[model samples]
Target: MKLLALVALTMCAFAANSVLNRIGVALQGMDPLDFATIRTGAGAAMLWALVGLRTAPRPVILSPKRIAGAAALATYMIGFSWAYLTLDAGLGALILFGVLQIVVFGWAVFEKGAIPLLRWCGAGVALIGLCVLLWPTGQASIPLGGATAMTVAGIAWAAYTLLGRSEADPLGATASNFLLCLPLVGAVMLWSGAGPMPFAGVLTACVAGAITSGLGYAMWYRALPSLPTTVAGIAQLSVPVIAVAAGVALLGEPLTARLIIAGGLVLGGIAISLAARR
Candidate 1:
């Protein structure tokens, strides 16, 4: 029950990030690059502080895992922010989680010999759901640039998740990844010359980084040990649903039939994939 609660909290936190990002960038006119920069910086600071309190300070070891994790983290942050500029919060969340499922499932099949037939069918169903969601409809259409960026973000996040699976010290590793990614994020900020940021947007980013992302991710890592891989994948399916509900209530985003159908299929398919017995 405790683990379930923790997992629920983590899922809420993850969903909250989508809400905050959409509010900050889309509603508040905050520059996506600036929001990304602040988010990464604040997350690093918060994680480092937590790590310091947990144990005596020590030099960070620059291992290959840390480096790759940092790069993937940076990619996810940048792409996520940029994509939100044009994508609706709910739609973006769906694409992000859908692609994430595919990446993780694909990795499993590659690393292991073969996936169970049930999972394959589930994957096929999920792919069909994605097609239905993305099919060009006269009523509304997703922006190409936004969809592409979110897809990349999903892939990067999957890589980050895979790399962190075996981590013994979740907090320390997460802190180190955030810290290492700073330089890369900074260079992009400089190169892009991000415009002025609103104070409200900055505050929103801070909360997202420190509370939702930093603490939320730490909790997730702690819970990971107790969860099976299939269970973990299925659990994240809740995030998009939560985000969509929040987006509608808070951001006044439209709740369309297409979104409803696609979401049902996507989440249902992923659930089927993970729940099926070998």
Candidate 2:
């Protein structure tokens, strides 16, 4: 129970990254792609320093499968960072997680062979809740391009997650993916001419990538084996709510009635789904 609680706290750190990115780009006058590139670069460097060189596990040779996983991670990181330039953190998370859940659920069906009807029904309810949460009021127009970018990011993340599950060592695989992906991300930043990275933005990206995100993943998998599928599923519902509250508190983003109600509905639906499973 304590370990699961700790994992949930670390996951909240992952959730905070969305808000942190918003602070770096939307508020701090930094280019989104540049921010993303620096984030990956810093995270890679940190992993190399912290775990890559000193690990006792036989250094896993990079394979085609691993490279493919890195590619997906790079795409996800870049697209996610870019999306925050125009989208609210909470809204962005809703879209990202919504798509991610669907993609991952599909992957389970196709790759894992079968999924319980209860899991499918839970997914459907979560999907409907996400739609309700994201259903725009007539006040502001949605940025289709930004939304598309986030959806692509979600797809990439699903791929990353699936790849991890197939690996011999999930944490080692994640570290390798992060280290290998920096160069790819760097090349994209150079090709796109994303220049003049802000000091504050770079720092925020680095902290988010290296510390919170890196440790978050380690803690998540550490707890996953101990947690029931239903408990794990419900625990994830805390992510978007954390993102929304973090956005409001850290980014000074407004918490509108629509946002509050919609977030509540999403969280509530997940709660109900978990309860049903129990």
Candidate 3:
């Protein structure tokens, strides 16, 4: 029960990243690239302080895994920040998690060469639910640009997770990942010509980076070892739900019928897919 609660906390932190980015970029009018840069830098600083210089991970960049992990982390950060420019917190999470699971499970099929029929069916249902969310209903439709960016972020995040699942030291690897990406993130912000963000936005970015992103990710990596692939996949299904509820409660985002119905189908389908694993 304690461990479950801990895992749940990690999920909350993940969900909080959406809210924080929304708070910074959407509500506070920070430039998306600037927010990403601040987040990467702040997260790197926090991780360095925690792990210290002598003990920090020095993953060999020559390995295919290292290059892939680094690229995925950068893509996830950049795309995630940019996506919040138009997306509501809940809506963004729905799109992100929906894409994330599809990619992860799709990779599973390739790796194992044998996924169950039930899992495939559930994946199909979830894909349909995602379409329902994306389709232009008379009242609301997800913005194509924001959805595309978040979809990219989601795929990158899944790649990062898969590649890092077997890390010998989750904390150190997280620290290394943050530090490695900090420079590129900063460069991207500079290239965008974003200047002088509001203090509120900076504060939100710092909180997201130092707490939710840096520390929360470390916790997630540590917990990954104890969870089977199917169980971990199922556990992440809670993130969208948590983000939706938080978006409504904290951000005052609407809880529309479209979102409710689509969220249920997407999350429920993914749950079925993961739960059916042998």
Candidate 4:
């Protein structure tokens, strides 16, 4: 019961990040670059604080693996923020989740040198769903740039997840990655010359970072050891759905028939792909 509750809360946190980002950038007039920068900074601070509470202070070691993790984190943060500028929160989450599944599945196939038939079929269905979602329509069309950015974010997040698979201490590693990404985030902000950020936007970004992202990640890591791999994969399918629902209820985003059809395909394909492995 506790595990179920934890998983549910973690999923909500993940979904909340998408909603918060959309509100911050799309509704609150926050610059994407600035939002990303503040989010990373705030997440780093929160994670480091948690680390301090959990462990004795020690000198940090810089490793290649950590650097790679940091780079992936930076990519995901920047791309996610930029994508939300134009993409509807629900749609962006769907794209990110769908692309993430494909990337991870693709990498698994590459590593194994053989693909399962069911996996291939699942991937094909997911691809078809993506096409349907991105297809031009008279009523409303997805922005190419926003979809592309979200795709990049999804790929980067997949890489980051893969990199963390073997970590001895998930929280410590994550905190280190967030801290290491701070410099890169700052560099991007400097190059872009992000505009002034409203206080509401800043607060939203901070909540996304410290609460939804930082603490959520920590809770997920804690729960991961108790979860079956398939269960973990299946549970994540809810994040997009939750995000879409939240967007409609909280942000007053439209619920279109096209999204319903495409989302079903994308999510169903992902579920089939993961379930086939069991």
**Roughly what TM-score does model 2 have, to 2 decimal places?**
0.84
Off by over 4 Å in 2: 52-55, 112-114, 132-134, 166-168, 221-237, 254-264, 272-278
Give me the candidate number with maximum lDDT. 1
Q: Which ten residues in a row have the lowest lDDT in candidate 3?
A: 53-62
Structural similarity to truth (TM-score) of each candidate: 0.86, 0.84, 0.83, 0.82
Ranking by lDDT: 1, 3, 4, 2
Backbone collision count in every prediction?
0, 0, 0, 0
Best by TM-score: 1
Decreasing TM-score order of the candidates: 1, 2, 3, 4
The true-versus-predicted C-alpha distance at residue 98 of model 3, in Å, is 1.4
lDDT of 3 by residue, 73-192 (tens): 889999999998888665777778777877777777677756667767766666666656545546887789999999999999988878767978887778778877887778887887
- The better-scoring model by lDDT among 2 and 4 is 4
Stretches off by above 4 angstroms in model 1 are 56-59, 113-136, 253-278
At residue 276, what lDDT does model 3 achieve? Answer: 68
lDDT of 2 by residue, 1-278 (tens): 59647866866887877777887888777888888877787766666565656656744649897798789989998899889877876578877877777676665556565455655566566656556655566788768888999999988976765555534565666677777888888888888887667788888888878876666655565565554443454456557767777767776768777667766666666656555555
Tally clashes: model 2: 0
lDDT assessment of candidate 1:
0.81
Candidate 2 has an lDDT of 0.71
CA lDDT, every prediction? 0.81, 0.71, 0.79, 0.78
